[model samples]
Target: MHRLITVALAVALGLGAGSQAAVPFYDTYQLQCRANFGAAFNLPAGSFFTSSTPAINNAGQVAVNLVNVNVPGNPPGVWFGQGGTGQVKFVAADSNATIGSISLNHLGRAVFPQNFTSPNGVYFYDAPSDTSGLLTTQPIGASSFGTPIVNDLGQVGYRVSFLGSNAWVSFAGAPPVAFHAVEAALDAASPYSFLFTPSFNNSRQIAGKVRLGAAGQTGENRPDQIRIINPDGTFTIIAHDRDSDPNSLFLSFDNSVALTDNGWVAFNANLFPAGRGVFFSNGVETRTIAVNTAGIVSTIESFGPAASASGLVAFRAFENNTALRAIWIGDGTTLRRVVREHDIVPTDLGPARIDQHDASPVFGGSITINRYGDVAFNAALTPPDNNQIEWGSGIFVALARTPGDVDCDGDVDFDDIDAFVAALSGPAAYAAQYPDCRWLNADCDGDGDVDFDDIDPFVALIGS
Candidate 1:
């Protein structure tokens, strides 16, 4: 199945034997993983990972939460590791301390919060610094809240507030500054209610859910909305419908929001009795993004939604009639299913894998998208019955599909030939080889078969 190319052609192209674009983001391809069940690189012992989602960065690094089962108490916390490696690494572990939520930035720095004890538990552990410490030592009432976030500039965002009291968005700086707080975050009412912590952009803009009372409307009450707090301290209402609409119906937003560096906001909202769906706000207009209009019935959209800088939104949606669940990525214009249950993955790792369970929805299993159009998601794997261990649950990273990056490692290299060869062997072989990768239509030359005729064009494309 090897493509017979002249040595001169291979050398002139500057690519080795296996170099080629594996596939496109919307089509057949194998998924490259960044983290999976294994021993911790730091502990060098076996570990167990929960069903929670992991954070990913542009460098293909994954921030995973691992519980070291080898330890007596089975202490669990955050760790950083890359795919294809034999080890997941430990980031931090404090005795009796619990890591609430963790997010990794583009720089691979991980920001996480431990128990409600403020000025003591919250910290940013930098792999390069080989250190960890209190980002904010100020006393924050233990509200059992707060999701730690790290941005591109290494800025960390954390929410500090007691239940029903004032809320503050604290950033770890030379001196921690609350990005927004009770009396200061909003301009509407005397008492402000903050729901979820605001999501931040590279420009330091923040998008959050807050409740504001609506006046001069019949039956239209105060609605929870997504608002953006700009660098100048002024806020813009990205999504809120506590007012009269042209259809005389009222709309409201959910507590979750994800914003990108380009000021696009992807938020969850209730469109009255029509059911909840994701809405996109580009500053001027906010409209409900449709999951599908082609289905027999309306596609049932699940609540958890994640948006990327390039305007791509990743979420779970299912067919109303068939109940066929799928993970989809949409760019407001084109929508495609990224993965679905039972689909085979094409990989060079000798054997393919399959998606065993639905990608975890929303809060627990979120689709983490990086700038390269790569997405990191969590899924349960179908175990191969042939003496291989149970494929268990794990986090997987999918590249946007580079044509010759057949190995799905995000580039065209000498390693893709084996994977491409497997893909040419048909779906059954592909599934057997890489259960996590989906079969591709590798008919490169449009000859109706993925055979010899496809070689020249594929090689030329890779060279170009």
Candidate 2:
């Protein structure tokens, strides 16, 4: 039966009658973090994460911002730790300053804005050297700094707001350079009047949203645009408000955009006609990952879309007609739910429900995904075993499974061959055969598909 199946598959996929080239084998390793609510790092008792957004690097290091709610006058601080390890250390804390959103790079370095401080500026903390310092002070004539994102090369990108102008700047251990500034001519016909949500990738490319036209120009309802500034200082518009084009599907985009190293940008936007959804584009083509529908979701949260270099997108959205929310990951064709509100999560303390509080205004949790597919996030949890000790909000990482593990049995072997073939048949057949496994496990090449192209890679995993 195995021989017959192999011959049929070879014939169907148009493989010639010859020995196939040796496909590189990717070693299967257990993820640093488990699917359970295992904390990436432990927080002090009674401390809660203030910012739901946590950043993760490809090395499985996680960083977050939190505050000690039990201590009066206690300052919020940024913390860093390795996934699935409890050894966590503080990056920075100040009683007189507030820490903004934190971004981490593969070097274990984190960058964030230290607000309300003397010489308020964006700061960096190097975990290996145990050192922290300011990266750049506020640009002259700037009122504040937006969230700063650090790339692997130690370059930082952020938005600076002036009295009446805003600009996106990139810093590389020296003076900052403004790549795009308000009142700068976007084209011969208009100037960019507004910029928001600047992001950086390893290629030194910057992506963000912009409004074309003069600042405060009346009767100018030009839709916002998503643009990228390339390494050569050239610009490319990924998507824009093209309401006049009958073929354009996007009506308007929200203020959130996430850029991946592979030059893909993920965002949330209002769809044409009426609805909201999460979509991604690579400057040439755009694809939808999820959209609000009657029974699936009522609204997709605009603030929590994250992209990965492996061509995956993660997002948060509310369940239809319910307050419950869920985190989902997609590769354009396949969507998987990572977790949801009220789901039980097993922790070091015990099992707890993924919960939220009315006091916390952040509707859905913030999320981030790395090149390796690991997702780091922050969430409030109901105390395990009804015990509040050492419990409140926590940072966690959901590590991705090894490639070609179609059965998701922790290892790739002969046991997965049938399931792999089923997955190649289609997602429905794969799910019908392996209800608990993910169809994405068959995406061996990591090109976001399960087809004949993955056959050699899958064979390499189990040996020729």
Highest lDDT, which number?
Answer: 2
Stretches off by above 4 angstroms in model 2 are 1-41, 67-72, 86-94, 176-178, 183-190, 218-220, 231-233, 243-247, 320-323, 357-364, 383-391, 402-464
Q: Any runs in candidate 1 off by more than 4 Å, and if so which?
A: 1-46, 67-70, 86-88, 91-95, 116-121, 138-145, 163-166, 183-191, 213-221, 242-250, 292-303, 319-322, 345-364, 384-390, 402-464
Candidate 1 lDDT by residue in tens digits, 317-415: 764555556666666554666766555554333343544433443123567776555677665554433324434454566656535544545345555
Residue 126, model 2: Cα distance from true site in angstroms = 0.8
Could you say which candidate leads in TM-score?
2
Residues 210-312 of candidate 2: C-alpha lDDT, one tens digit per residue:
7776656422366577888764457888887764344677788888799988788999988878888888898798888888854466678767588876667
- Residue 343 in model 1: shift from native, Å? 2.3
Q: What lDDT does each candidate get?
A: 0.56, 0.68
- Lowest summed lDDT across 10 adjacent residues in model 2 is found at 21-30
